[model samples]
Target: MDQVTAAFDATPRRDFLPRAVRRRASYDGPLGIAAGQTNSQPRTVDDMLRLLDVRAGQRVLDVGAGSGWTTALLAHLVGPAGSVLGVELEPELVSFGSGNLARTDRPWASIRQAEPGVLGDADGAPYDRILVSAMADALPVALVDQLADDGVLVVPVDGTMLRVTNPGAVVTAHGRYRFVPLR
Candidate 1:
């Protein structure tokens, strides 16, 4: 089985969700989380992760980290040698997500409140992989610049799931996907 799939089995989705929706964790559709955000459908997240091709020791950035589900999964994928930084916009979710992440005892992964009017964590640039759960109207040049020389980013842009590699910033569309607009 693929590493992403293995990660899914290792990290229970219900652990990262709000109590009200924990029973619905196995549902294929997206579930509501704090601050009107969705945790994203499992299938979509799996697709994004497979496209990203995250390695065991690559540093990853998870934009729109929502409930820190993806962050914890990324931490599992990277193992102890890597780290993951998840940034979320809503303060409520920030606190909620932070607490969820803490339960996993994965010190290498953390969710932080996103800065006002800022995109990803700029200070932690040069990420080996970036996964954006929100949708953008167009390619976010700012995020592409955050990539390391050979980094990869999986994002939803204009309804299309795009796998973008650094260097030339090559982009390939996977399929159509719906997501909350990027703030």
Candidate 2:
């Protein structure tokens, strides 16, 4: 398997899921967690990671990190040299995701609560890669501005998945995908 797939395989999904739905951890479908948030499907996560092309020593931003699954996976890909910051709007989910990520022993990855309507971490601006799990009505300008010179951002806009590149100058649509709207 490729590196991304290998990372997915190595990271235990069960660890990131809520106890009640732990049994379906490997189901490959989205499962609801608390606060009306749902983990993205495994396939969708994989696809987005592939598009992001994350690499070791490359800092990444994970927007709408529900259960910290994507955050942990990105941590694995980025290794110790890189860092990952996950932003969630829900306070409970921020705690939940932080707790889940703590188990991974990856100090480089962390989850934090974001203010309502905030797109990305401005304080942690200029991310090498950014992955948005939730769908936005349109491209979030703030997030686009946060990308590094050659950064890549994979986000769901309208009903399609878009891979935005560098300074947010280019946008390529991947395909249709359903996701919870970004709050």
Candidate 3:
């Protein structure tokens, strides 16, 4: 199986889901979380992670990390040698995501709150791979700037899934998708 699928299989999706929707954790569709956010559908997450092509020791950033499901998946992909930083705009989600992540016992990954209007984590700049779970009206410059040379960023922009590489030098649209707007 592909690395993305392996990561998905290893990580328990239900662990990141709210208790109210825990029964539907294995459902293929998105489910509501706190702070008016919804976890990205399983297929969408799989597609993005495949496009990202994460390695075993790369630094990754997960933006709009609502429930930390994707973040945990990334952590699994990166393994113990690598690290992942998940940034959320909502304070409650930061706590919720962090709490969910704590159960994994993976010290290489963490979730924190981002200031309003901030698109990515500047403190963790030069990410080897970046994934944005929320939709943006246009490509978020801050996120692109955070990419290392030849880095890949998978994000939803204007209803399309866009894979950006080489620090915004190359952008490929991978068809349509729905996501909550990035705050």
Candidate 4:
């Protein structure tokens, strides 16, 4: 099995969800969380992670980390040597996601509130792998700029999923997808 599948097995989605929605953890579809956000669908998350092709010991930034589920999964794929930073726009989700992340043994991963009007964690730029769970009408140049040389960024743009590779910026379309618009 691939490492992404292993991460899913090791990190349960239900752990990141509120108790009210835990029963629907296996639903495969997105579930509503606080601040009117949704935990991304499992299949979509898997696809994004696969496209990211994360390696061990690489730094990753997770955009729109609604529940910290994908953040934890990325942490698992990167292993102990790597680190993951999950930034969320919603204050409620920041606390909720951070709390869920704290339950895991992946000390290298963390969730924090995103700064208003910021596209991504520029202060923590040059991320080896970046996973964006939100949709943007246009490809976010700011995020692409934050990628390290040869870094990979998987994001949804204008309802289509895109895999962006740095150091030349090769872009490939995966398929149609839906997510909350990037703030």
RMSD to true structure for each model, in Å:
0.8, 1.0, 1.0, 0.7
Q: Which of the two candidates, 2 or 3, achieves a greater lDDT against the reference? A: 2
The lDDT per prediction is 0.93, 0.92, 0.91, 0.94
lDDT (tens digit, per residue) of candidate 4 on 84-110:
999999999999999999899899999
TM-score of each: 0.98, 0.97, 0.97, 0.98
In the range 156-182, model 3's lDDT, one tens digit per residue, is: 999999999994459999989999988
lDDT of 2 by residue, 75-157 (tens): 99999999999999999999999999999999999999888867889888899999999989998889889999999999999
> On a 0 to 100 scale, what is the lDDT of residue 94 in model 4?
95
Tell me the deviation in Å of residue 86 in model 4: 0.5
Candidate 4 C-alpha error for residue 106, in Å:
0.8
Residue 153 of model 4 has an lDDT of 93
RMSD of 1: 0.8
Off by over 4 Å in 3: none
Error of 3 at 128 (Å): 0.5
Candidate 1 wrong stretches, greater than 4 Å: none
